[model samples]
Target: MSEDERATAEGMQTCWSDSTPGEIHASFSGHRTLCGKPVIEANPIYASRLGDITCSKCGGIAVFDEGAARTRVREVLDKWIAKGKLTPASATEMGNLAIDVFPGRAFTSRRKGHSWNKISTDFLLASGAATDKDASARFVGELGLAVFEGLQASEYQGKY
Candidate 1:
């Protein structure tokens, strides 16, 4: 079989295992290549070592999340709080920007009696590269295995 055909066949055969803990097989993250011809992204960092996920049209970082905006605003608010930089009025203004700039993009979900959000594993799994049930299951299995293996490795290192 040809290379692409062979790769596809291999991917199809891979299965997730709940019992095992090291990457059982290659993940979609490792196996699949982005489709279409790639273009040069205008991002300052993109001009350097661009990865496969770079956008084909604009050569942008192909951000699935509003990570940059969130990080910047968070850092600013944190810095202001650290330096006692914000007056009551200024704090209110920056706080407004913080809430409005990345509305609905917050990684954390509101919890009972809590003002901040927590990470959602469900959201992450849902947004992964795999589209179908089977593919997703397999990917999750392989990922679980990888994580388990890493934990074991770390434990072993600590013992030595």
Candidate 2:
């Protein structure tokens, strides 16, 4: 891991109930989390992709803090600006690029779910915990997907 990554992980270690998240069920049962989002079942096809329960909005508070992520995004933006690939006036565009790294809900014939593959560094130069360079895009992309899937799991701890 990189120095910055090590520092952030050490600083804000999550308070999960176990080394791995618990509380997944075999089927959807219309249960709702404390935060009111309908608890969803583990997407078996991708369960291997996640690490814990989601809906922590009510299961627990994650604080939604992105201090380190913001710092990195700005750093990437500055580099892009310096390369003349962007401009000082591109603050709005920079913000949009940053936001694009987050996974969004998607629907398939079977169910509605987050698009983990979409959360890559190809379009976004940086996220709250990831970055990209031509030489590191592959590793960064995989890491970004893993981090996002874990976040998805933690965010939905309401129950499967």
Candidate 3:
């Protein structure tokens, strides 16, 4: 391979395990698809192409912190609830707080369930965890921290 190609390949390898800024940005451009289905289609083309903003990896848009918000809020919350550090009522309260804190960004449950909620990244902006390029990175870092704390609390001790 050419020198530049070899260098890029090496860098890509690192990003595969621990993504870099450029890699994340580049990867974000491609839509996630699987089994002839797209997971995350472009918002604009979603309506015409895939009919929705579903993520090919998760089968749905995954909202914000549904499964992999990078922040792992749900996982942390689940752990806290499991360990008795947080109650379902409290978890619901946090979800509501998230909604109240980020009015338009919070995802509200349309169903008749008390556990339904929405996710948004507005907290990242509001908390100054990120401003531009580092927003997602900061959020992911926070998610890692949440997971760490949950583990420390013995909630997701062995589940991970």
Candidate 4:
């Protein structure tokens, strides 16, 4: 028999099917030993992808489309600026940082090379928007929320 036939006889098999829009199908394959009790495990792909928008490896279901995320982040920053929580210049800086952090942008980079947290902190310091520790923490927390909302929104749209 051919290698594939042998593998099938040995209880190894693979299957593929069409996935919904904005998603991909992936599967795992491994050996299954009877005596040694070899184990095989598989997990469903639980993340969505659209163009450059996708969940981080560790982000699980989190996902975001580039344009929508950028617009959402900018709107949140604008609200903060209007409320006097952040200066216009600081808001602009934060908006720029968001653009860089989100996927589908040329500036997108992993946290290793360009960390969103570090960039937000630096922007706050340089812009003098939230120099105090408590204030800075709160500001960063707000940014985090904005990002989360953007991601969730994208995921919802991708599903339907």
Candidate 5:
């Protein structure tokens, strides 16, 4: 089989236990989730569907309780505050970043998929790349794996 075919046959990647945590939301700050290597996100599909989940930014793999999520947020804020990255007032302003989401609320994002137009993933799986059921959609400025995998370096004429 072809390389792309081989990748597609392996199916979407459901395990995020081995991945580095990505951003929780693109709307707010670009803080990292405390997943590190969380297990619940090993099966993102299952995690995202549940409530009272943790805020690991692992999306489908947050395993902590609400209290834990709150604590985690505080910890992150503390670290940032100490580093001068955040102040008490700024932290309080974005207090609900990930601390308050739980117990019927899940901290996850849209599914990861692909598109021919590279604009929507609702149509098909990403060729030569594993689909992440829990990963947030690829944002601008970040490299597009599917687009980059098969192209020549010289082909990057300032656009994908």
Candidate 6:
């Protein structure tokens, strides 16, 4: 038999055996019922990770780095407040919204081992704040540009 066929046969045999050594089996025999009705089934995190549930639609398997996102959001918000563009309360609210909405982690290589927790343009669409999708994207781009400008200005001031 071919290697694939042999492997399939072995797997089938393993499934049929009652006591397979070095194999772990899932047991739901002791599940509790709610008022004589079957309770909803819920899998553990490891089970979900092992299954095909780690896709982007399911939020993926990335670790959340809330600290980094919070810091960046606070920095941007503070700069705006100092510039008189945003009131202190408004800055706080926007910073809270950003922390709540954006993912605190990403699986991109551009982060270089650091967490990619920055807010994305798609967040505007997801949060229903974008009347026009293109405009929202442009707004996010402009926000990024503004942050870069603020960084440059800070660096220029620090040089003196």
Residue-level lDDT of model 5, residues 1-160, one tens digit each, is 1233212111212343334344231101112223344333433333332222233243322222333334445655576578776678976555453233221122222222232234323212432223544323221111232222222111212211
**Per-residue C-alpha lDDT of model 6 across residues 85-112, encoded as one tens digit per residue:** 7788976776655444333123221123
- Using lDDT as the yardstick, the better of models 1 and 5 is 5
lDDT of each: 0.30, 0.35, 0.31, 0.43, 0.31, 0.34
* Deviating ranges (above 4 Å) for candidate 5: 1-64, 101-160
TM, every model: 0.19, 0.30, 0.24, 0.38, 0.26, 0.38
lDDT for each residue of candidate 1 in 24-108, tens digit (9 for 90 to 100): 2212232322222222221223222222212221111121112333344445545555677555576446544433322223211
Q: Candidate 4 on 1-160: residue-level lDDT in tens? A: 2323222112222222222233222222323211112234323223322222222321211223344556777878887788888888988888767644543221223323444456445545654556556766666656655664554455422221
Question: Which should have the higher lDDT, number 2 or number 3?
Answer: 2
Which regions in candidate 1 have their CA more than 4 angstroms from the true location? Answer: 1-64, 87-160
**Could you tell me which 10 consecutive residues in candidate 2 have the lowest summed lDDT?**
103-112
lDDT of candidate 3 over 71-141, digit per residue (tens): 34576557667877668887656644432222112212211121221122343444555554563455444
Pairs of residues at least 3 apart in sequence or in different chains that clash in candidate 4: none
lDDT of 2 by residue, 1-160 (tens): 2333322111222222222356431112224332334444334333322223343332222222233344445555566567775676784464444334332221110023334355343334443334434524543443344434344343433222
- Which runs in model 2 stand beyond 4 Å of their true positions? 1-64, 100-160
TM-score of 1: 0.19
